[model samples]
Target: MKYLIFGSKGQLAQEFINFFEKSSIQYKPLSKEELDVRDLDKVVNVVKEYKPDVIINCSAYNQVDRAQSFPEEAFSVNTLGVSNLGITCKEFKIFLVHYSTDYVFDGTKQDFYTEEDLPNPLNKYGESKLLGEFFIKNTLENYLIFRVSWVYGKGKQNFLYKLNQWAAANSMLKIAVDEFSVPTSTRTIVEITLKALKQGLTGLYHLTNSGYASRYEWSKEYLKLKQVDKLIYPAYQSDFNLPAKRPKWSVMSNQKISKILNTDIPLWNEELKLMVREMDI
Candidate 1:
């Protein structure tokens, strides 16, 4: 089956490209410079030209705090852009595979969030992503919307990369103790997505690692694995005083997808080790 991938330069998209190439899957990867998904006319033309059976959208506006100052930009890419793709995919009868985020929820739930859970986004970034999901669900029937969280991989855009940079720059670090979510690896996302596609699963599901962690906990584990000697002080989310308000407990449950795939996802720390080894860090 032929696949068309958007946002090829992202960590997640890069993982997808690597796996698809290794597996000899036919696909065309496009960067934001090559084609911005917000342009409906261009998006339609590209889909028509490629005629791909599946469109894997890795495009997203991920700047949480910046999104508050630039909601238009966030909505343009995360919402309107997704809407454009959904419209074109529906017109072409193509299956769409899009990625959402855990930020879609407001973290009001005491336990893990499921697919059935209603979304109540706290920030503009989250609002944009949630709206993108709505557009796809309202427009298309055959689509896989995976809401992932705390994603990290080969690129320099993730939390792990920032943590390493902080470790190198300073001997002490302050990480948020209240912010919580599963640290999902891009490798796991790509593998599970492929499996789900093969099984013809079409619905929204929370795709993440087996467990959850606060920013402080995650930072400690990562530092321990890398043998970094930095002293990390646990701090509350309010201490940072960011522009966008974040959910204190945004962990999502992957039981829905895991049961369907019949595969248990690796723990966050285990996946971190694998990623570190793979990156030769």
Candidate 2:
């Protein structure tokens, strides 16, 4: 099967490329500059030209706090771009895989959210992602939408990178204990997504790590792994006073994917350990 991946420069996209390269599948990875999704004409033309069996859209505007100030740009890239991709994929009868966020929910509920839960986004970024989800569901029948939370991995500006940077520069790190979610590793997401593609799975699925943790808890554990004894302070959301409203508890349950694939995903701590080993930090 021929797979065409968008946002080839992203960490998740890179992991997908690595997986595809090792597997028997053939793939064509394209960066944003290579195939600008914002251009509807270019997106349509590319799909028609490649005629790939699968289209994995890893491209997105993922700036949560910045989206508050630039909602239009976020909407243009996340919502409109996804709409164009969905239309093109539907026209070609290709399988579309889209990545969504746990921010789509308001995070009022204490329990872990399932795929059946209704989305009530509180911020602009979440709203834009939800719009993309709506477009894909309504426009394309063969689509797999994976809504993940607190994604961190070998990325340029992810949570882990920020934490490492802070730990390196400062003796003490102040992290939020109020906000909580399962920190998903990009490696796990790539593995599960590849398995789903091989099995031709469709519809919405919640893909996240096995456990949940707050920013403070995750930082504490990560710092310990890094052999740093810096005092990690736990603070509430009110202390930071960010422009965007974050979900208090947006941990997602991966039971649906596990039940379908008959496999178990590693816990967040275990995944983090692997990541730390890879980074040698």
Candidate 3:
């Protein structure tokens, strides 16, 4: 199958590239410089030229706080750009595999969120991603959308990477205790995506680790695994006072995907411990 990846330089994009490289899959990776999604004409042209069986969109505007100040930029990439891709994919009869986020939910649910749950994003970034989902769902019939949570691995900006670096240098750390979600590995995400495709499972599904953890709890696990001697303290989200309002609860249920794939997902701490041991961090 011919696979084409957009946003070739993103964190998750890099992971996809690595996976494809090690596999027998043939794919064309396009950076923003190579192909801007907002340029509808160019996007349509690229789709026609590539004639790919699947177009995996790794492109996203992820700056949560900055998105509030630059909603246009976020929407251009997250919503409008996705709309263009969906339009072109629909025209070309290509299966579009897109990634969404758990942030689409407002965290009002006391338990985990399912695919049937209504999305009410609290921040501009979340709103943009949620709209992107709508664009694809409305524009195309052949599409698979996976809503992932707290992705980490082979990325400098992720929580584990930052906390590992900080705990190594600093003696103390202050982490938010309120924010909670399952931390997922990029490798696991890629594997699940491929497996789901093989199983002919297509549609919107919530994908994450089997369990959940708060920022503080997740950080302590990482530090403990790394054997860092940092004195970690608990802090609330209000302590930081960021520009974007966050959902107090961000855990998502992965039962839908798991049931279709008939695969069991590891707990957040289980995955974290494995990653910590596997990597030199």
Candidate 4:
């Protein structure tokens, strides 16, 4: 099957590329510069030209704080861009695989969120992504939307990278203790996506490492693995003074996915160890 992947330069995109390289899969990767998703005409043209069996859209406006100031750009890229892709894919009968985030839900519920829960986004970024989700679900029949959270891996930009940098340069690092969610690894996400493709699964699913952790807790684990635990300190969200309001509880339950796939997700600590070992941390 010919697979076309957008957002080729991102960490998840790179991981997907690596997975494709090792397998016998035929795939094409495109960066934002190569194909601007915001332009409907260009997006339609690219879809027609590639004629891929599966189209994985990894491109998104991920700047959470900056999105507050540039809501229109965020909505255009995350919502309108996705709408264009979905319409084109629908016309050609291509399987559309899109990634979403747990931020789509407000942190009002104390327990883990299920697929049936209604989305109430708290920030512009979340609102934009939720809008994209609606467009895809309404426009396309052959599609799978995977909602993930707290994604990190050997990426150019991620929480892990920032933690590493802070640990090396500063004597101490303060992280938010109240903000909580399941931290997902890029490798796990790619593997799950590939598995879903193999199984011909099509629907919405929540994908993340088995357990949840606060930003402070997750950072502490990373620091411990790096032998820099002493340098880290926990602080409340109000102390950070961020521009955008984040969900206090973004944990997602993967019971549905596990039942469908007959497999369990790895624990956050186990995946963290694997990541650290793979990166030789």
lDDT, each prediction? 0.94, 0.90, 0.88, 0.89
Ranking the candidates on lDDT from highest down gives: 1, 2, 4, 3
How many Å off is the CA of 136 in candidate 4? 0.3
Q: Which runs in model 2 stand beyond 4 Å of their true positions?
A: 279-281
Model 4: which ten-residue window has the lowest total lDDT? 225-234
Writing each residue's lDDT as its tens digit, candidate 1 over 1-281 gives 99999999999999999998899999999999999999999989998888999999999999999999989999999999999999999899999999999998999999999999899999999999999999999999999999999999888889989999989999899999999999999999999999999999999999999899999999998888888888999999999999999999999999999999999999988888988777643
**TM-score for all models, in order of appearance:** 0.98, 0.97, 0.96, 0.97
Clash pairs detected, candidate 4? none
Models sorted by TM-score, best on top: 1, 4, 2, 3
The model with the greatest TM-score is 1
Error of 1 at 252 (Å): 0.5
RMSD, every candidate, angstroms: 0.8, 1.2, 1.3, 1.1
What residue runs in model 3 are displaced by over 4 Å at the alpha carbon?
A: none
Against the true structure, whose lDDT is highest?
Answer: 1
- Candidate 4 residues lying further than 4 Å off, grouped into runs, are none
TM-score of 3: 0.96
Clashes (candidate 1): 0
lDDT of 4 by residue, 1-281 (tens): 99999999988898899888999689999999999788888878887888899999999899999998889988998999999899989888999999999999999998999999999999999999999999999998889999999888767668888778877788878889999999889989998888888899998999888989999989988888877746567789889888879999999998888888888889988998998988653
Candidate 2 clash figure, as a count: 0
